[model samples]
Target: MERAGFWSRLWALLLDGLMITIPLNLIWFMYQGEWTNNITQGWAWDIVYAAYMTILPVIWNGYVIGKRVLTIQIRKEGDQPVGLLQMFIREIIGKLFLGIATFGIASIISAFMIAFREDKRAIHDKLARTYVKNRI
Candidate 1:
């Protein structure tokens, strides 16, 4: 039940972000013939990102694509699998709200918390009473 390290978690998140971005960019390119128009579709992308974070982990047993690839999983406080409600709280309330309110500044802070905190719990993880751990 060892907590996942900050670097590992950061790389996983980047992978997930890329997973979302690459497809969207390709679709935009095919439809609009350009990939540089991301700003105009930021809101739509955010919604997709929110859905990605919330639904995937619950359906995938606490592992998003990135987490699965990285051999890490999100778990409840007692090392149990995350419930749907927990995923909602973590991804919607904690991540989505903070991401929008601060224009993604809060996510940066969450990374710092994970990096420096003894428990390696980011704000979202603390809010959801969840932690990322190396999958057994």
Candidate 2:
């Protein structure tokens, strides 16, 4: 299986960001009964982001909405199913933990790793021992 290239993965990320944002925005609207307040000021957005990353791949065969559209999927190093533990490490530890504590600096480093590293493994994938593979 071919490894997914950085640009393709980046596009997939953008798409997934949009997908996550839309529903989150709606939830904010319904909760606050307004559309202008900042949702990032609290833990709601963070929780949503964590759940989106962790839960989706576990239930969807490693294919989040963007990965599904981009013909890419996350897998164990040897093409195994992504375990819940792996998902938790990747999503919660690698993304949410670093994102919160570092104010996204660590996530930025992960982006650079994806852009320049030979295997295109981000910090999350490295921590989880996973890879994103092109489906076709």
Candidate 3:
């Protein structure tokens, strides 16, 4: 079967984010009544989201609940199961650039490149040595 492309993977991520946002926001509200009232609480929620994004992919064989629902899984370039270290690097370090303006620009370029690149790898995927593929 053909590999999944960058857009497909991005669509899956958007769906995943939508799935998690409600519960995460609710948890944040329980910790602090409003998002602006407590910086520490906001940071705490960020940590939780980070941990969820990072650890779930590793433990679930690269399919977080969203990806699983989308029938996609992350794997190494040669189709090996993704390891924890790779997941950490991918979900943490690779995605960290997303918060910075310059890095965001870089991300756009990287994403466009990934769309047409032969290996079908986004910047995070290249850095982490991973790919998202349709589950067999």
Best by TM-score: 1
lDDT of each: 0.88, 0.87, 0.75
Give the TM-scores of the predictions, in the order they appear: 0.87, 0.87, 0.79
Q: Which scores better on TM-score, 2 or 3?
A: 2
Superior by lDDT: candidate 2 or candidate 3:
2
Candidate 1 Cα deviation (angstroms), residue 135 = 1.7
Cα lDDT tens digits, model 2, 2-116, are: 7887888999889988897777779879988888536545687778777888889989999999999999999988899898999999989988887778999988888898888
Angstrom error of the Cα, residue 90, model 2: value is 0.5
Of the two candidates 1 and 2, the one with more favorable TM-score, higher being better, is 1
By the lDDT metric, which is better: model 1 or model 3?
1
Best by lDDT: 1
Local accuracy of candidate 3 as per-residue lDDT tens digits, 30-102 = 8878654343255665676678778888788888877787788889778888888888778777776453546
- The per-candidate count of clashes, in order, stands at 0, 0, 0
Which stretches of candidate 1 lie above 4 Å from their native place?
A: 37-41, 102-105
**In model 1, what is the error at residue 123, expressed in angstroms?**
0.9
